[model samples]
Target: MKQIGNVYLIAAISIVGGGLFGFDISSMSAIISGDSYLCYFQQGPLNADGSCSGPHADVQGGITASMAGGSWLAALISGLLSDRFGRKKAIMIGSVIWVIGCIIVSASQDIAMLIVGRVINGFCVGICSAQVPVYISEIAPPTKRGRLVGAQQWAITWGILIMFYISYGCSYIKGPAAFRIPWALQMIPAILLFFGMMFLPESPRWLAAHDRWEECERVLILVHGKGDPDSPWVAREFREIKEWCEIERQAKAVTYLSLLSPKMINRTHIGLFTQIWSQLTGMNVMMYYITYVFTMAGLTGNTLLVSSSIQYVINVVMTVPALLYVDRIGRRPTLLVGAALMAIWLFANAGILATYGTNPGPGGVDGIPEASVSVTGAPSKAVIACSYLFVASYAPTWGPVSWIYPPELYPNHVRGKAVALATSGNWAFNFALGYFVPPAFVNIRWETYIIFGVFCVAMFFHVFFIFPETAGKPLEEVMEMFEDPNGIPYLGTPAWKTKNYYSATARMEHGEGLEKKMSMEASPERHEVVGAKEQV
Candidate 1:
């Protein structure tokens, strides 16, 4: 049977894995504030307002974080599986795991069971999150890589928005169905992803890594050349893949330690931190606990839920511009500007809540187990606005760039493992923050925003000085830039310039060293693609 080779269509379907991430975020966030979930789980002490508060902060945090914890563990191994089995198969495996997890969550009768379900669900998320971007990056052309990979983040935002509304509608349900129904519905996408993957081809780069050159070229032609074997763009891209594969074949097989090598260490650090800092940006914190943030701001019930929904809508909308233009806007400017904007909003939120928040005690508005400091009037609106602006800034910049940046940094040999490591960094901090925020809300209250605000500030300088500009450069030249003797590895070019803008034919015509006869129009039958300086 013929598999789907349209890159855009593949990206759209494969990103269901990303949508599962959105589902997980809103599944818990949307309902945690609702009484049905809190009372059914017996989280903390039940209140007259159906809101509970106190002693189970840790338990509540644990339950909320179990999925993250499971993702953390699953992400660690996802790379190995992706490498050994193939990207398509790895995604399918994660989908199966996701369905199982949702089933477990849907049926759970107690807290332990819920935790188990969430952890299982998290395991699926870990695998998908780590692999989805890697898979997309490998299949997509360099010029369009950012846009294709950004679809994963876009899918995630869509998932969050869709699931939040689903949970919000279910909020009126009288019993456990409020949360259970949403958790069960999570299965539908995972099942779709599992079957959808069956009709998609594996990554061309993955094929090359395993020495399947003909199939590799076919995939490249299919996805990049529109089935034209002699397409110039396809020819150039194929040769680059060939040359890079030849280089990677001589290197030691990738292991965790290989990432520490002098050549790879710079990219390893950069990739890992890019992901780590994404979590520290406090975006997920807002994602997981925005209801709490808005509650503290003064809205409750449908009012608060609808307010949070708008933020998710903003998240979905703001991401589109970046998705279309990131390659042209460049990764550095987006991250720099995004960090600056996020910092301003976080600080704004901190100031508003710090000055005006008051303890509302056990009443805690409505639908919550407990309430701490609360805000009302203009200050509450200001705090809510800050949350909206923060998501607006994050959705386009770090949200997509973080996932797009890391996977593109490495060659095929180490991409699976390296991206897995970097992604694991994301899951690790994501897990810690998941567990940390509930208590932070209790102990430090408004001050939590201050910490994230500080983090945003620190990351601005980090990206300014260290992160290399990768926009529009081919993967081969990116590796070459890192290996360039003139600059440090992480800082690929001496300056962030497009070093290889000329295509193979253009360079040949311009006499940039290659013989004119070595044109991209050379016979498609030639299988031995040699080095740039060598004869074809």
Candidate 2:
């Protein structure tokens, strides 16, 4: 019970890193569209009515993309840092960086300063995004892993929802201080995470890998037993971990190049493409630009803010179902169902926008349409409804699933690098979307939804034909799935429907197979020694 408590506490604190990630996603959406922001950034002259006077699409995209760009680089390197210094330390370093970034962003005097601040924050996000899930997966039992790791995504949604409301409340304030207050508020989670992590135990897997067997045993007992290292369940789990660490130590030294081995490549591909497909789903388009989207739907001022807040609320509420059921229902099913639902909503949104939506007039600035002149009734409401449905579908499936899938795919030796590469893919594509969406909306209007709709269809096929089921399987057994040629013979079949899918670890737990294999591999003389003992 205490062990489980520790796991939840660690997860709770660690996911605040995810909250900082979410806070940044929508922070600029509200601030960048404001008149004070425009005037202060010097993008162009302000109107007599106090609106941005001209298009500043480039500036907007640059500011948003800069964070992703920094994250891209940071994610690529964070794996090395985490592997060397440990996941907890990497997260603490990131939290400190996050505080630094929040201070800089809150105090920015110009666009350049703002970009630098956002980049620093993005760098922190990169480190946390890659490390948090790895840390959670290491600590959580397989049965609870999905929900626990899923908490990171929940934190992100909460961060987005909270920041969205904060930005909205501050939208009423009259100066740069409006945006500064929200930017400064980002420091709260970072501070909490940094201080909270100081008391948590380091990953037991990492400890075993470093040959700190005593500490590893203690942590496992604390996490898996009642502070009794000799408890049967704890002994079995620790033995397996130690055995795997020994095997890895004897096989080959783990390095970046080791990921290219045939055994690891498939898992690597799964991790990388999952993140890529997630970005292609177009969730961020709505997440980072809900106010802009609501504006296009003919809402303005406080009305737009309230409507956007509803979208985020729906996101937070729907995510709860996923937390409850992802382990029960499994990862692949949720993803396939989500992709199909998101596709339908995307197409419906596109159809509504194409037929009845309005484009921004030539004089509009920063992608906000000038003076609502388009459909105001049923079509507008339909577009809003479809957008909400899209977010609802995403909240449960891709939103949390993407973060949960990658870290579990690799063995401990290269788990850090695999997650780093996958996270970098997430941010790289995230950067592309962030950089392009404002311009895409301005130039293509409703067609943007069509593009995302196509990506959703593609995602459905990918999940059905490619992703293997990992739920309920132990981490070491999951590695064997990738290595076994017949483990995933029916990729298109739901995991529950597949006959070939079975848990080797569960079979071991039942005393069916592992003892024989361990004896054969770990000690050929075990049988002889047992025979001699029996004869005596």
Candidate 3:
């Protein structure tokens, strides 16, 4: 089969796997606000007041969270599948599963059926979400790595925006069609990705690990060297990957537990924290429950939908700058700045809600209110702006960085498992938040923002203190930097003081090979041992 060699095309297509995630996020946001959807899920007659009677708060929260629960489990197991079957194949499998899930969801008749379908789709999200970045990171050159991997975030934003609008438009239709149409529409990207991945090359590093050296070299040549066999870039990268493969071949088997080894644990923490903190930033609340937030802010009907849709546009638009400049700006600064800005927005929004909002029932843990807090006038508008600004702050920073950073943290041997573990942490928190945030709105009201705001502040310090920069560094160099005994510091002259360590080490090893070759020239085994050592 003819393979796509352009990094951009591969990123664009493989990233379609994450599209369902975007769809699920904003689709539910858009669908749940519809009277038809509420009526359908309620499975009963409308209230005598002509209001749609939705499912109970707990049942609704479970329905909303079921997908994340499924995603968490799928992401946990995805690494083994990717390692055994290859990243591209793993993603292809995910695409097919997503299509099935979409079909089931579109036809769901009750809350249980809907939850089952969403959970199935969540499995697809988990598998694809874990591996797409792994695949892209392996194929992309170090300099372009950020842009390509960041494209995952950009694509997700696009999915969210497109699906949200589709659901918004479908909202006008009578009955369950309002929700079913959008669910059915989501299958397109998955089907495209299923067929699209057929034409995309598998990860070169994966090929190298399996000892398919020729295919690996060809991939490196085609993707990075512009088809030039003699290109210095390809020659250098191939050498590094080949060496890593050789090293890994002799290493012990890697498992999830292996990620906690002394050499790997710090990176595990970094990767895990990188993903965890992103969810803790409260971006998903704005995304998954935007309509709820807007509803509480006193906006209704088209005005609420329009207001919600604009944020999706902002999400898509804001991601572009990060997609272009993340490598240039470096990872550490983007994370720190993003966290700080998100903190400001969350804090400001929380304060505004606490001061301007009115609570009628003030529900407790056992007795949750139907509506937590309601605001009207300028304060509600200000609260809405804060939500938009929070998303704007997040889109360029944590949104892209979280997806890219974890895959960059480990060597090929453990990269799949480690990335999966990190992603599992992400989905775990995602599921927890998705499951609880709805009830939280009733129980605590404005305090939710306060928790996330503090998390943003804490994450800022964490990034500054412990998180090392990974942007533009070759995987081997990142590996060595973490393995260094003295350690890279955040406060005291940090993140690998030596530049070009990977290349320099490669040269030193090459020079040693030459000296050994010269010494072997006098030995009887010269013809056998040192004959083709320098060929690559």
| Per-residue alpha-carbon lDDT of candidate 2 for residues 331-402, written as tens digits (9 for 90 to 100) | 889999999999999999778777876554654433354222245688878878989999999999999999
TM-score of each: 0.91, 0.90, 0.90
Better of 2 and 3 by lDDT: 3
Off by over 4 Å in 3: 43-48, 362-370, 486-536
lDDT score, residue 305, model 3? 92
Maximum-TM-score candidate: 1
Which ranges of candidate 2 are over 4 A from the true structure?
A: 1-5, 47-50, 364-373, 485-536
Q: How accurate is candidate 3 locally (lDDT)?
A: 0.84
lDDT, residue 439, candidate 2: 79
**Candidates 1 and 2, the one with greater TM-score:** 1
Runs in model 1 with CA error above 4 Å? 48-55, 361-371, 487-536
- Candidate 3 structure, TM-score to reference: 0.90
By summed lDDT, the worst window of 10 consecutive residues in model 1 runs over 527-536
